[model samples]
Target: MAGGRKPCRAVTARLRRSVNRRPGTASPCPWPCTFYSVVAGHLDGGEEVKAAAIRDAREGAGITIAPENMRVVGVMHRRAGDERIDFFLVAERWTGGIVNAEPHKCDDLSWFDLDRLPENVIPYVRRAIESFHRGVWFDSFGWEE
Candidate 1:
């Protein structure tokens, strides 16, 4: 269930229908699009659901990088099935902003020294932070296909 290579069944279903199924069925993540949308409304029908992310940055501890100065440097594509991957670049710059919980997606957030991180930081994010310290690179490298 972890770490192997296979074509996306989702993409295959789009190109050739299964023998037992009809053709032209709409597949998820249809071709050539990385953007999707979901409709949301509050129970009161007066609110809109908005997706959000909690981002934090830390610098020092024998390191010269800063998440506050991060930038989108490159995006590597390896069409696993029907999705494109993204990677953001971070640089060293000083700034001050409290690491707080992500209102929606991230339930908690905090800044940790390179040697010490929050107990609940996502696994993938923790890996990326580690890679930064080792001078290796990781961005969605351990996620998805």
Candidate 2:
């Protein structure tokens, strides 16, 4: 791991924005991807899982979220090349707008429709998103059966 830590756990937020198209509209619809990484950070000592999710969202994406508004949508256990447990959370309600608080870590941040994800998305990430859409609760990757 980049940081000196073991048994690492990370959090990612899935923020969805709905686009409604009215009748007789000729404009191209800009339905951005609903799955976006709001924030991610290592789980600190004695920190509750939900607390970490809220903290990461604020620190990484500059968005304030409440514990009540966030829900655990899915989880991925990845060990292809690295070992990690990823927590995927879906936030329906949040306060404040989203901004790339850590520009140095991330160069670009934008919403992408689930159907039209970028080609650069990691295989596990794409799998997780698909699992999310299909309402799958748990998944494991890079592990021999």
Candidate 3:
């Protein structure tokens, strides 16, 4: 998805980027957040982007979907390091409905149980979710990091 058309930048929030506490203190990013990673071959990214997406997903936060493919992004960055895995999410595939922030960007959004996802899901997404349970988040370029 690559954030659709525009490039995404880190906000650098203390809560979001709490470079405080211990190295492995209570998990860095939030859970259950959504990311908009790319879906293709090859990998490209740094530790920062991966962290953002993982934190977003673990914290259960939702993100805006890109207009290009009509899907929301979700990063599956790992805190332990080595960019474990990254992934993307098609907004329409989840349950519930889309948010009202950007109508054109996203039409059908859903808050999936996160525990039980639907069939035909992207491979990388499945992997990310699997790692999330163990707190072993990884970074995958096109996966959704």
Q: Whole-model lDDT for model 1 versus the true structure?
A: 0.29
Best by lDDT: 2
Model 2 lDDT per residue over 33-95, tens place: 332333456677688777887887787678888889988888888784557888877778889
- For residues 1-145, write the lDDT of model 3, one tens digit per residue: 5646423333211111111111112223222223321221122345454344333332232333223323224444433223343344333322322233332332223434556555433344455555545555344434334
Candidates sorted by lDDT, descending order?
2, 3, 1
Each candidate's number of clashing pairs is: 0, 2, 31
Q: How high is the CA lDDT of each candidate model?
A: 0.29, 0.64, 0.33
Question: Higher lDDT: candidate 2 or 3?
Answer: 2
Give every collision pair in model 2.
33-112, 33-113
TM-score, every prediction: 0.35, 0.73, 0.32
Better of 1 and 3 by lDDT: 3
2 versus 3: better TM-score goes to: 2
Which 10 residues in a row give candidate 1 its minimum summed lDDT? 11-20
lDDT for predicted candidate 2 compared with the true structure: 0.64
